[model samples]
Target: MSSKVPIFTLSNGVRMPSVGLGTWQMTGDEGKTVIRNAILAGYRHIDTATLYQNEDQIGDALAELFAEGVVKRDDLFITTKAFCHEVAPDVIEEALRNSLKRLRLDYVDLYLAHIPAATRECGSHRTDVKVEDIWKGLEKLYSLGLTKSIGVSNFNESQIERIVKIQKVPIHVSQLELHLYLPQKAHREICKKHSIIITAYATLGSPGRMSVIGADGKPLFESTKNIPNELNDKNVKALAQKYNKTPVQILLRATVDMGIVVIPKTTNPERMKENINLFDFSISKAEVNLLEAHERSKPERLFWWPNVSEHPEDPFAAER
Candidate 1:
């Protein structure tokens, strides 16, 4: 059969693999093994964030990959985020240089601003400057050939449009929270219009990580009408049976079918291998509709808000 995965070319002409490995909570010596496993399992792209504090481990895996000659430097598309204190111009370059040193590479495939928050919190690792300053720094880095592509994460439509108006360079990607619950259809459309590709994080709603509490302090899953009470919702379960896969697999496949890129974080080797097996199957249109009906208008935000209260234009704060 032909490859069903669709890869969109960025404005810069970089070919990003639609399905890549996401390393969020996975860190330390264990990350090296997991990353190596992902590469061996056919993942050509790897997404890491400076905030994740695991670049050293990812770097170790890259070194091994280089030594073994399994993947050449240009063959792999490695993406790293510049967040926290690195949002300033000089600091951004310094951070990229640090990330490069950690990964033992000359240039990164894509570098993203982890969050669109213009200022750092009272006590946060982020910088107190605006994103536009960071964008200028990123553009300069691109011109210097330190990075092949530059982009942002968690940026809203207005923020992105503002950047587009002033950007001397085009953004190649916008990494955000996207899943069966948080469809982000409008955001996806805006990115498409600007030729900005989106990379999805929290694809599974982070089942292993505890869900945020609601206004009553109860788990959001308990009160949120959007999420099914249990992972084994009837539609998801039935589809799982039909596909001969798990509910998670069905969800990932559905996301991919919608022409989006997803990076589900998993430390378990077995689950990592299972997640990549998504390439082996397809979900039917009828099944996709069934899944769509389960889509929650306000899915519980697994990644929380106290960190976002600093941003003046948070969409979810007012709606949910």
Candidate 2:
């Protein structure tokens, strides 16, 4: 099953599996079981964040998989993010070290800044931080062997340019809320120019995002009540029918065909298999074009963190 999945080579020459299991709002013993099941279903890459509060559970699950000889540490690629105060330049290294302790790993395959925004531990946004400052910290982590590669998330073009100007290490990956509704063509082009591999979250419109709580214990997706769900998109459904595959499969396969990595989350055992089985089929260029036709006039973002605008580099400010 692992051999069936294709890999994308990052600019740093690291190999990341195109399809990874997204673990957001997945917690407790139940989350561990689901994570273990995701790997059993053939996922070699797993995405997590310190904000997810489930790294310990994932750590436990992976330990079990290792004990059973299901997978070796090198056989998998694990990516984790540091958000909020963790993005602080001074706190960045310690935050990642703590994350490593939670993940029970010496180093993660990829470590993302998660967002350009920074906040105080009390949830108040901090506007004084610069993205290049944070990039320097991530670069330090890379030098210390804390994370194999470093990148940014939820950054606008200007912010990306700012980091690129002063980067000692190139941004290796860009994880963003990309879906058929908001294909992010411009962002993709910028990343392509920089040779930064994009790891797309919310690829299927992220209905599951509604469950992700914010810093204040409220659902983040509630603020953006009108997100376009790809599951309800007629064009995507038609492509799914034409291809004789589930709509979920069509949407995910299209994103992968674009050379963008996707991490769609699900707990159903059957959906797990379906998500990883995408390698068996292929979508033609014309059909991919048809899917691309559904791009929303404006980008649709699911997470609008509280007081996000207070951060100088709020990437979604224009969208709001």
Candidate 3:
């Protein structure tokens, strides 16, 4: 296998590994093992969020590694996000401090405003927080040096532009649901204009998750007539077979080629190693052209889109 890709430097001068282990569904002991193994496997970046409820497990693993002198705290790039309805200055500060406490770290490498919500509804978890107010609080955190870098998740072009205009500092990253099925191309242009790096989640189309608008609960990437549909387009599968790689690896290479960071969340050790093994291969221009041709195929949104009618903060409402 080729040498692992070096970490990417953020717009703020903070270096973050382009590939990392995402800890979304992982929980309890399973969460710790996934993180520790990923670290031992040579992953320096780890993605986590308060909503995951596994911060304490990550903390324990990091503590254990530190005690064993396996890795120094500065060597690892840790990222965590704070959800909407916690954008109040005090609440945001408290949430961040709590994250630091749970992760057993002095500060996080990167902290994101998980979702944009309104200030009045922040403490009540009302899910109506405004994006600008949240940006204000994030800027505060950046100024305080409590977070090495500050950014957003699930933000669109317009939302990102507004934040850039008002931010006291530049945004270093914007995490979004980007995959073979749903590539947010237009918004990516806006991010590029602001020098904001895009980090993709659900990089595999999240095959195991439920569809957002389907009542029958169709899988995000269902196959038809022995051919994979959605993100697993015949072309993608063909490329995967040609390279002796999984469709997931193809999707990841495509995103990485676009200069976007990918984090495919999985607790399975083999899969974790498989997901990060892409540095050894490179996709050709012709292959990327074939994948682009299928880009207009039906797009799928996997995660929750709660009360879209009521929540303007909802990212799913943003145009793809």
Write one digit per residue (lDDT tens) for candidate 3, span 1-320: 01395567899889888888888778899999888888887788899998789999999999999999988988888999986546655579888989999999998989998876543432334443567778888888888888999989877677888877777888899999876657777878888888888999887766545322244576533432222334557888888899998888888888788888887788788888888888678899888867866655656555543423246666656442
**Alpha-carbon local distance difference test for all models:** 0.77, 0.87, 0.78
List, in order, the clash count of every candidate structure: 1, 0, 5
- Model 2: residue 53 alpha-carbon error in angstroms: 0.3
- Write one digit per residue (lDDT tens) for candidate 1, span 1-320: 01334565688898877777898767788999989888777777889988888999999998998899988887788899887556667678888999999988999999998876544424353434566777898899899898899998887777788889889999889988776666787888899899888888878776644544656777754433345433467877888898799988888888777667878777777887778778677788877777767766565455644455645444345544
Q: Candidate 3: which stretches are off by over 4 Å?
A: 1-3, 118-129, 210-231, 307-309, 318-320
How far does residue 11 in candidate 3 sit from its true spot (Å)?
0.7
Which TM-score value belongs to model 2?
0.95
Model number with the top lDDT? 2
The digit string of per-residue lDDT tens for model 2 on 202-226 reads: 8877777776676789876686767
Give the TM-scores of the predictions, in the order they appear: 0.86, 0.95, 0.88
What value of lDDT does candidate 2 attain over all alpha carbons? Answer: 0.87
Candidate 1 residue 13 Cα shift, in angstroms, is 1.2
Give the lDDT ranking, best first: 2, 3, 1
